[model samples]
Target: MTETDIPALLALRDNPPFEKMHTVAISGMGPVGMVAALRLAQLGHDVIVFEALGGLSAEARASTFHPSSLELLEQLGVVEELHAVGLKAPIYQYRERSGAVLSQMDMTLLEGETAYPYRLQSEQNNLTEIILGKLQDMPNVTLRFNSPVARVERGDRHVRIHLEGGHRDEPILAQWMIACDGAASPTRKSLGIAFEGTTYDDRFLVISTTHEFREDLGEDLAYVSYIYDPTEWGVLLRTPNHWRALFPVTDAETDEEVMSAENMEARMQRLNPKDTPYEIVHRNVYAVNMRSASTYASGQVLLAGDAAHCNNPLGGMGMNSGIHDAWAAVECINAVLTEGVDATHAATLYSELRRDAAINHVQARAQKNYDNMRQDDDAARAEQADQLSAMDRDLFEKREHQRNSAMFTSLRLTLGRLKRELHAVKAPAVSGGQKFSKLLGQGPVYAAGAYDAVSAKLVEQAGFKAVYVPGSAVSASVMGQPDLGYIGLAEMAEAVRRITAATDLPVIVDGDTGYGGVLQAAEAVRRLEQVGAAGIQFEDQLAPKRCGHLAGKALVETEEMVAKVKIAVAERTSAVIIARTDAKGVEGFEGALARAAAYAEAGADLVFAEGVYSLEELTALRDAVRTVVGGRPLMVNLSEAGDSSALPPLELAHEAGVGFLIHPVSAVLAAAEGIAATYQRLLTTGASGKGQEDWKQFTTLLRQDEQLERASRLAAGEA
Candidate 1:
């Protein structure tokens, strides 16, 4: 049915009396706040929306609303109005730089899963206006433009909002307050909650034109397209009135150079090569950030939308997630007020659910979207294209992909968490240390090295017992540098956290020289344990230590190394501590055995005799350490190109009495080789050597279908 003829859908039902209802003060008049205010007013609560701006913005921002967001808008009674004005896009495409479509995603795969099976292309301002018009008719809704909140004071029963230049001279009071005040929220700052994450080095230039891109380029063009070009990756989206192109500008180019009339014209011409200069309607340059508030609630004040989390606009998830946050926050607030649930408890649950969604779903997805388009490596880009094409050809895979891209999975997960909370059902917790210990008890354990979460997932899929997070691998992959003690404890721990979060396998991290002396070692152990590390290996090397295989490495005194091991053992709760002695390369095998015995005496769970080159050397060292330390578990490094290059195979090492065998760089080396080959093929042939079937098999191994099943169960409230 046409949206203009859907009056029945837009009609509001009768609600409870508002005379005895409490008031809610919302600190922003953006789309999120407007939706929240309208929903609360519909539920018979008085709501006041305060906007710092004089009026709504005409600028283009966040133009795509996902299916999950459309469902919420439907609940708020504005979906019909939105449909009347906005454009519905059933497909989106990924294209090459020359405008050749490489892959296309059909949103129809989500037909049965969501009421609105396609994304809606509508400006943020359009939504705000429609919501405002409906709110003006409701007596319980009051919107005050140009009213900015200065500071908020939370009380026992209410919240006091001090205005900077509000409609009334006196402070405003409400039973609850919501801050939807954008990324740099004053309310969030006043509450002293940290907005933590990274900002992109490149700024995005959003240019809108009335010119018809589809007419010039082909009628087959989707409403939205991401063009992948190593030099100039950009995105194109069609609005009701205009088409917008988003281009990335690096710091190397000055703002004046990027925004100059000639440069802008040149960019448009390159996009389509039209004779006439593209008529510009609006243009804006803004920095994109991936940041989230540490907590979504502070006392009586709660944060929603951009105030709670902000991300790059690559995947069009920011606005949709914000709208979801609005509904969730209002629901939690309603539960507290009407259902007699404790306010603090409700707020805490809301914070946990929304914060996790923002971080894991919105931010992570947006970042990956940006990365996929902006990948500089030809081979990686081709591989990504192959994977997308594979998804396009497979029904189940496409449905799974649609679930994530359409934001249905995130909403389902959030609802599942809420359901579990309400039902008082707890999920089983998996302890990293316990898993590692279980594997250790089952005989010889071999761990594959991983530098990032993706690699860790590959290792887990390969059925590895554990993941070894080597310091050298982390330094090279994360920091793009050599592993000469350039990374600190915090950076390494964060990497460990990401890897551990991505896979269920136990992760053992490399703690280089424990980052410092005994105190630093203790703190490092504490931090690693907090991040769910299963084990940490500290080498007996001086500060600024080089890789064990590298030349010119120095060792710390045996007593000093023993002290650090003792401190690590004392500080960690359940994490296994492996003390690595590098004395074999410096002070010979006997000295290394002595240092190992000392570390064992200091309560080290495992002893690694680093730099053992040959089988004879390994066996002698292991026998001597066993004699000295009474059969303490020993770890052997079986590198393909490092100091242990001459070591025997895995079975041989196991037979030679090695409890743990780590191939620290084999995974990284294999990745480097595969990537180089793929890039070479793409550069030479302009096609990926890996076919669609190969990509389908690879993605299946990644368990994309299993993930979709879980999301489906959660959405059905079965999880």
Candidate 2:
């Protein structure tokens, strides 16, 4: 208000004082913001945390901490305090409105998979408060409450952070800044980043009461239960103090009308009637929106937690993903600050990892949960229930548990992808697509056929370069039919999924003639890539395509096949596209070679002329195709059923310039022979060869190794 103060402020704006410089200035002091602050302080970065609110927010939100969150909290040394006050909910249920338990999940099965196998049910504020306590004594940390960010300006070398509450004379200059502000981030808006997605028509209501559901719902009730009713689907969760229930309130009712005393009581009674008024602990109505920023980073400033993305909290992935984002942000920031990485490069890496986890995993799963919980179709509901209930088998249980616990999507897969992309650590384990992409230039890669997990594992154990999952073998094994396109996209994808999960080897899946057209072929490319196919081979044959070696196989027009190949290339996400032509059988050698060349021009990574006759012809075909494709690579499948069976030896084919050779039905044929012999001997002499594997070997292949190793350490007093 004074002339002297105006001049001082103008001077301050021009050049921030030395006292205002910090290593990092973070906006917001919520859970995500605090986690970043804690990590930065631990790493010796001078940190200043700004909170718009007076102190910690005590809103009744996000009480579930997943297994992966527990591990992360443990690393920060605050998990034990969380465990002390929180309830360990290891069992969650899915049920019908009539109280029929459709499915129940037991988290104890994850004992060996994670240290803390249960979800910790405590308010998120508890963890933030614990972190605050840890940060209070650190010399490098400053926690500023009620200090709203006035504006943020990104400069080339440093970011300027202006505080709103009585800090006009001071603007902090930070080496970098991270915005952990909540969903309605003005910072993101100021940077002109779009938060793009949909807002639901229904507003969700959360009513917490001391009224116990466990006492009324009987002994079979789980601490966490999702009750499905098309008209009034709801989620019931038992926190330490109260049973919290979430229900969707239609937009027909205004917020006040929906939250009226009469409406509230009636809703509670409708869910479970009580003779008296329910003891209400807390209630809130919030709009649910599934939205993510176009990009999480804007120049020198980065966004994390709810600032980067927010979604409907149906799957409890909201706060959990935010915390995961915090971890990721800190890691990326560490690279910039300590590892001498360029700031822009590190910021982009953070944006890709967190934004991907949000859009692909968190946002997608949450929307799916909302849809499934309120599913109206009777048959679809029944099928969903059956699928959930059917996750009782050990393999199914492990996979389901990992997915539900947020271990696979949020941590293992997403984080593994980040590590691989960074290539900063000794992290060899990466996404299969990356591994397969790296293997292309290396010559003479041979792939052995595998129809199942055991066969795929055996392929890896036998020192093969890759695993070849041919459609013919999958159709014969899974559907008991020849590869005449009887096996659909779903069936093939599932087989590919199982094989990819079973082995670390790059898998080349056979996509028989795209399954339909350019669009269907594009979908096939997406689905197969999703299930971890490193390379997908599509052949140039007409619908109901017979095996490539078969005589009755019809060839599609050369231009059409070329179009399909181009679509496959465009649709793929790092998967090698191999184009096969069965024209050698139908058309002559020159025709086949010409089609192959056309396909290569259409952007196929590998060219395959399916039925080449002799070694001399094959050699000439290889040289011609290689030259035409500019020496990318060529593929060949050596199966006894194929026309090339007469030209037997694999060594000679490699010498003929085959870059990738697949032993397409060899394992299936050998397995059939061995199994048939065992069955005959058992029928005749009453004894099966190797009557079941020794139980010990089976256990060793799975979860027993880590537990046994820990036990040995305990026994030896390794400390």
Candidate 3:
């Protein structure tokens, strides 16, 4: 493509011709809805955006745009315009009320990770103006101000949106509808999806002033600073023309007492001891909530922005995450309507991923920021200070901390982690089986054990080939119970379901004692397969089976155990069935070999010789099992505490002919030990024992540098 034709060519490539065009109605013309409408129009869809208000309101709301949000705006071709009018804040600080910097987070650390690595301080109204201006220019987009959506009615083919008091009485009909209304979304309420979560008892007072506090203090300060004080913890943020202060108001304080002109002047004066009374231009009070819709989409009606979820504004993630929701909704909508993808499946995945990010990242981090600032207990405050100091001292930890605090990594991380899940859900059903078999042949695979979705994601990022869901680890971590077969088939299957959904890595679950007899073993296989297990290891132990290394373990008859193995193998379609025998502790090494041979004969794809006492024994067991089932894989359980003949290096296991080396409890064990030590240090010394600079570098490695660069190039029209 020549330079002259490049723009047209790139536009054509980016905007693919849709097989079928769609009319999408979006309610609530806030930033979220407007962005969604613009994106849909770009994707060759007819978009109509409705607004309850007569026009955009110049309200004091979220004013900081993190790197991720900027990247999203850049994708919509408005970041440059925003940056021209917005102030760039490269650093933000956590400070004491007395103007002492406790810790400073430099957004520049995200330099290589995102296109726009600094926080942009601008009024929310500016963004609205830019988006509204763009929307007005799009021929395919319809902007309807003062057109409130009364109710959303879903039909078999399309969605009908009823307007409350519009000039036209006819209801709007569209193939898809997105709700971008605020938190008290009428559409969400009409759909009956619970907006469930906590609402803080304290109301926040936000005040704007033109007076320059930094000039009076005579010290360079971050554009945004969270001040910690037991008496009056609050947040200070700078906008283009004004500085804003947000303070918490307790039940003891009345609105009149907190919002009075004298109170506002006093609070601002306390920060800098101004020569004259501080000028407060405007002030507003509002309660913060951590609420989310049960689902983002129901039928053809989808929810975005505050309509789907809302959270405390401490981390400035509410609007950012809502924008993310808008993009995700449009992508899924386009995929379903134009790309021949399943609508229900795409919508469900959107709901699952966005809701998860909102709750786990946005809400959780906002709560942490709030708690860190308002901690009253002396020891707790000291510990929090130490943690922040550590983040400041270590660039890696600081970058990771800043990523979450700025909401720069929320969307990227969420979607990146869910890529495999999206593929699994959208791909042909037989792909899972094929993928599992292919992964098996690629052994000797090292599988990390995980009990939760977060751990599973970390394992996937750590470059593990698969996840091993150990019964012992799951029982201990999830239920705080011992691994004595207390966790049944249903519980284990559910755990596998979550881990598998969170990642694309093949997961092998420990089906202890098959949860019962042979019939139960068949049922267990079916349940695990249905929930997306790539493989399951069935151990040869009686009901209530204990850990292999633990005492009081009993095994069923060899024939009976062989029967269960056969049942598992027969019931599973694409799931690998590995038969594990705990016979070493009871029937001696020779007897264990015999049981392994029988299980192999019963069509087990892999044989696990549990509790081998030495490297020699493991080698011997692998050789013997190979003799019984030529060329078939053998699994080795490398437990730190279990009777693994020797904890040989992974290379040695491969040399010894072991196909799968499973560290059954290593991940959770290390996490538990680390957390315990950290907590113990905090309890004793009121600080983390490790030096401030000595922190794990995992989060740094999780940064999306390449993805951000790609987005930057795309936004700049650099094909």
Candidate 4:
């Protein structure tokens, strides 16, 4: 593909409808680059992507797509093609080098959770090629192959990038430049930013063996199978019809010295040492490194994919994380150019968000994996295994002890007594006819479907103070949640101030995880008070809180949560503080009640026990908290088909002497079921569209009217 082959641009003058003021030059036509370009094009931005190679990069780097990443591709219109060309791995297996059965983790465990519950095997080269094909069909996207940017200069409002292989010596000027230029980014280097991290000195020989192990390993052996041993460590993984073995190289030897086909077979013999016939067909050396950019964006120039961060492929995080970075970059860039918001602020947030996510989650997990794989000493391994066994045994012992211990029961009664004592403490009396109202939905609405119209219309017409979460086809599909933010105290206060700008309704701002530690919650409360929110509720769940509906969720320590409540209470000037406990399943009502009573003493205005199962539990809770909290509100998660007891929300609210009831997820829950159904239909039909004929019309309602109007004007100017 050449610049002249950009079919849409060649016909632009004839079309007369194709023109734009701000052109975003996306460097690199790799998967990350292509996805970003595609999203920008769909948003009616003029996108010119530069690729160094004549076509797609030929490196067979990433050979599989994670389910989460695949969902993003499904939104981008390439998931079907991926499934067609790629092998779906539904089962994961682990085995000892001596063919001993260890443990196998089946992806079937994730069957109902995600639409695509398995990984797909397809080379990154092919994936890039496919994305390039999609970009070619877009009228707003220009794919400039064999043209790499030699230099990038960022001015106050525009960016200038000089291409090496182009006909002209003149540089291309655009509003933004994204460097998806792979692991070694010259664009990033040109900005004088240092990538901070350590590169692993130890290398591994990655051999692609033609020998099929499926017959012996079983057809279901499509997984990340690790062969554990101190020395001669290896990992056997599937790639379509072939198998790849990763053999670790010792410290004294170099790749050339230890990775020949003969030596490869020898190492495999040492690790496997089995009767199964597996031979090396191809051998290559890989030096895994852990590195992240100090910054993701420098002025108008930004980084994505491997350019931003790279990690060892221990849990297949390296490539998947890059894909996530691509989605984030697209959202941030769109917010800047289209929304006319603070692009700099958005970029800073993006950098920190992606960088922290990769470092704390991916890099940390990779390091832990290395420890798990390279465990050498026999005594040490034995001790570790024994410790694991002991922990499992201890779980049973603890449960039995809890059942028998009089101390445990006495502790519960003492907490109950504390609750009664706190209840006796008089709450400020409600003045005659004095009204207090809590504004809900200060954040984005997540549910879609027919309910989307209901939720959107409700916010639009309710006269209730609220804000709309922007809806983008790419963002809405990939992030699996609406984008919402308050940034800092000032920004949050600004949001609250604006809600009252239109109406007098009190706002209930979603203070996600309290923004910081318990010590900081008070400061957050002070900030929220300035913003004009009447109340703020902080959850017991940890940061980057999983969607409240997901299972196997973990809650934070009870004491730490109580401390946060205390901080929130100490900090609040006017805004009411609500403490939400997610200890329903992770811990039972006893733990939940204990935490709630503690929070009331800490000065919480309301106590919320989420995920409660029955009226019996809800009644018990209301009776328990009434003693300590007094007339302060009690809130319960009102679920239609949820575990919040068989009691209706209003009746329960009245019975429990609860002052408030929050439907934190009513609209979202309804939206999820509908969006999920629509996704299923799209997957089955293999049709590319906005779903129903009226979907295009319906989506306009889903967006913030003013933002969409602004976007339409921008798109029109581009056309």
Of the pair 2 and 4, which is ahead by TM-score? Answer: 2
Models ranked on TM-score? 2, 3, 1, 4
Error of 2 at 17 (Å): 7.3
Query: What are the per-model numbers of colliding residue pairs?
Result: 0, 0, 3, 13
Question: What TM-score does structure 1 among the candidates reach?
Answer: 0.56
All candidates: TM-score: 0.56, 0.57, 0.56, 0.52
**Distance (Å) between predicted and true CA of 640, model 3?**
88
* Prediction 4 TM-score vs. true: 0.52
Off by over 4 Å in 4: 1-22, 165-169, 218-220, 273-279, 383-719
Best by lDDT: 1
Write one digit per residue (lDDT tens) for candidate 3, span 1-719. 11233233223323322211136889887778878988899888888888888998777797988888888888899899998889999988889988888988778888888877789998777888998888888888878888888888776435767788644323456678899988989999888889999889989989998888688654578899999998689988899989898888888888899888888888777766767887788899888888989898899888889999998889788888888889888888887767556667777888888988888888888888888888899999899889888877888788778777767567876667446555444524443444555554423456779988878888888777788899988898778998877898878988988988888888888998898899999999999989888888899888879888887788899999989988898899878888999898899988888888788888888888777545566677665663211132578776777645445544444445556667778888898999999999999999987763444344444345666888999999998
Q: How accurate is candidate 3 locally (lDDT)?
A: 0.79
The whole-model lDDT of each prediction reads 0.81, 0.79, 0.79, 0.61
lDDT of 2 by residue, 299-343 (tens): 878898898899987768888888888888787777766766666
For model 4, the local distance difference test gives 0.61
